[model samples]
Target: ARPRVGYFYTGKTGSQLLTEKIKKLQVYQYQSMPVVVDESVSVYDAICTMFLEDVGTLFVVDKNSSLVGVLSRKDLLRASLGNSNLEAIPVNIIMTRMPNITFCHKDDLIIDVAEKIIEKQIDAVPVVKHTEHGYEVIGRLTKTNMTKVLVDIAKDEII
Candidate 1:
């Protein structure tokens, strides 16, 4: 069967609104709890907790609950390599700066967002949205989820 035609909804529908296209687009989306940590927390505890789990990337939020920065395995490694007493150091010092961060809107088209990820050569895109308050991260757009969605699409195309 060919990939079902993608369509938009009306003022609002029920479950019918959830089409095959939407599911495919969201197949790789992870929007539950962000891997966030306090800026004041020791990198040692953060690293210990993060490593024990099997997540690919970890999002670092500050005391204000704003996106202070992002920390990757490579960043932690580099920090450890540079410091013999890395335990005392905070993740913020070694994390990628917010300006260098790439953000994705939850409402943005997934296809468009995925293209951005490819164009930027970034491993992940932080899903953020601004309310009257400030930027709140709702999810993480990661390469792993993208790959999974693409694979499912391919399977559908084959069948």
Candidate 2:
């Protein structure tokens, strides 16, 4: 057999190649470190952590460090309103609890996650790993990460 050398055109267009690359992109490829808070954390404290961490979403964990809920900036904001003492309110009281929180796994396609984010009108989703007890928060996938991927693809940096 002749040695296959040099570049050979398979007749795929640049857009097709780009689409394929995007499809192959997984949650782990662009996920960021998750900012987590204990479910018992005060709303005031959770708000402070969110600001300090500069994250739009915060994962709420139980005593076992298993994901229990999710706290978004909106949730904190809502809790802050009509309440003079945010410190007295635990995040779990206002957090989107289990069975309601949207999450993705590391192996999930970024495109699917993006669609979920869009369809749910959320800014971010927690990247989790399922354990015997429950889901463990491992990373965070946000709109910002998706934007970065788009920019990188445009620059051909992902190729």
Candidate 3:
């Protein structure tokens, strides 16, 4: 006797349909631990943190551990290209400040975060939540996260 398959798909092209299905998934389903660095940390230290964490972006936090800014690989590259002192320059000086930083929440739709990343041309988005003090960084959504989802879907193992 043949084994029963848990999922099946016809020869129909359903890109839009699949996208709609993916959009229904929450960010927490695939979010990674955010790579956080203090805003006062040197740009050089931030680079080291990124390398150690194996992430392309870093979330800048303030003394209260609230989300303050965002720093990307491009940001570091730009700073390094200039004649400024990397060791003395703080990440906050070059980071994209809050209110301008694009982010999502744990309960947010993953597809929406993906769209924001694409639309904003950013490598990742800090998953945040509003606290009594301010927004706190909870997790992170990156292109890799979406790619993993796509790969799983291709293998017919989407969650």
Candidate 4:
């Protein structure tokens, strides 16, 4: 659960083991790292369906790659209606600010992560960690996948 701990996603573990493995089926697994918008991207792009394919939240990182904020769909709509040049307005103006964004490390267990997401009422959690240069995103966990994990666990308990 702590930051910087390394882990494999369930089947990705490629070994006969359960401990220390985070389930891939229990979290978001994208074909590639989705194109992330920094603090300066256009709102037009924000509304683009292409940008939303695998992203549940628009992560706003600073120039240094540290997560600075997040922009949810509602936030984007509110800004779009208020600004004529939605495409040109800086994202920093509308993004959910720091100190409120909750992130998880990739190594965290799925059950522990599930509780955090449910308690926080977050649809998605950003997976992040520190580097010599700065913190960077590595993955994402979504409510959809968490639901699957919950079902699987329930089935196991019954049987």
Candidate 4: tens digits of C-alpha lDDT, residues 51-102: 5465667777878887877777778878888889876777888888778887
> Model 3: per-residue lDDT, tens digit, 47-145?
999999899999999999999999999999999999468999999999999799998999999888888888989989999999987999999999999
Ranked candidates, highest lDDT first: 2, 3, 1, 4
User: TM-score: which is higher, 1 or 4?
Assistant: 1
State which candidate has the highest lDDT: 2
Predicted model with the maximum TM-score:
2
Q: Cα lDDT for residue 31, model 3?
A: 96
Clash count, candidate 3: 0
TM-score for all models, in order of appearance? 0.74, 0.92, 0.86, 0.67
Clashes of each: 0, 0, 0, 0
Itemize residue pairs with steric clashes in candidate 4: none
Scored against the true structure, residue 91 in model 2 reaches a CA lDDT of 92
Better of 2 and 4 by TM-score: 2
lDDT of 2 by residue, 10-128 (tens): 67765677789889999999999999999888999999999999999999999989999999888888889879999899999999998999999999999999999999999999999
lDDT of 4: 0.66
**Where in model 2 is the C-alpha error above 4 Å?**
1-11
Better structure of 1 and 2 per TM-score:
2
Candidate number with the higher lDDT (3 or 4): 3
- Per-residue lDDT for 95 in model 3? 95
Q: What is the C-alpha lDDT of each candidate?
A: 0.69, 0.91, 0.88, 0.66
